[model samples]
Target: MLGEMHDVLHEFPDLKDKINELHDNDAEFAKLMDTHDQLDDKIRGLEEHEQPVSDFHMEDLKKQRALLKDQIYDILRGLS
Candidate 1:
């Protein structure tokens, strides 16, 4: 489970419609999601491939991903 995918849609299945609508119409939301996905990819790659990186760096990336998820959730909540 080290490299598990944390896809936004998967994370918030109930908000799928809202997420897609925002992704299509809101550039900022799309960008944030894109960055989150990129971070997830990086983290997954590091863990899956056993890439060498400091623990602090890995923790920092995870923190950033969590922050992005929270921001996305806040946006979804406002709309939902």
Candidate 2:
């Protein structure tokens, strides 16, 4: 869906509390979250036609988002 929120909590509902805790205390985790958010926004913009980008560029963006999501999941797993 276009314009859907893609925040960390939304991506990992089960780790809501841990995500909040890390966001408050872990600098690296916070930075990763920010990067993930920016990537998500850019991808959404392209998807919704708000930003013009080549198909290749859009695919690259999606790949980056997937990598970030995996990294985030790893962090969350480590926190468990």
Candidate 3:
């Protein structure tokens, strides 16, 4: 199992209420957050266990996750 958790709620505990509001009310935000969490899970699983994916693919996944995080952060930061 992965040793670390990088979920949105974990990353921004202070913005718990805001995150919940957006997650429940904003369809786009919810979709992006869902995607981010899925990517996190995939990346962590790949890291802990061997997989057939190439180094490049793994890096690409990480990059995608980072972008999603930035987008989510921007939204949260604007309100907070």
Candidate 1: segments with Cα more than 4 A from true spot? none
For candidate 1, lDDT tens digit of each residue in 1-80? 89899979878998999999999999999999899988999999999999999999999999999999999999899942
lDDT of 2: 0.83
Greater TM-score among 1 and 3 belongs to: 1
Cα lDDT of model 3 overall?
0.88
Query: What's the best-to-worst order under lDDT?
Result: 1, 3, 2
**Distance from true position, residue 74, model 2, in Å?**
0.4
Expressed as tens digits, the lDDT of each residue in 1-80 for candidate 3 is 35377888988899999999999999999999999999998988887776678989988988998999999999988843
Using TM-score as the measure, which candidate wins? 1
Among all windows of ten consecutive residues in candidate 1, which has the lowest summed lDDT? Answer: 71-80
Q: What residue runs in model 3 are displaced by over 4 Å at the alpha carbon?
A: 1-3
TM-score of each: 0.93, 0.85, 0.86
Model 3 residue 16 lDDT?
96
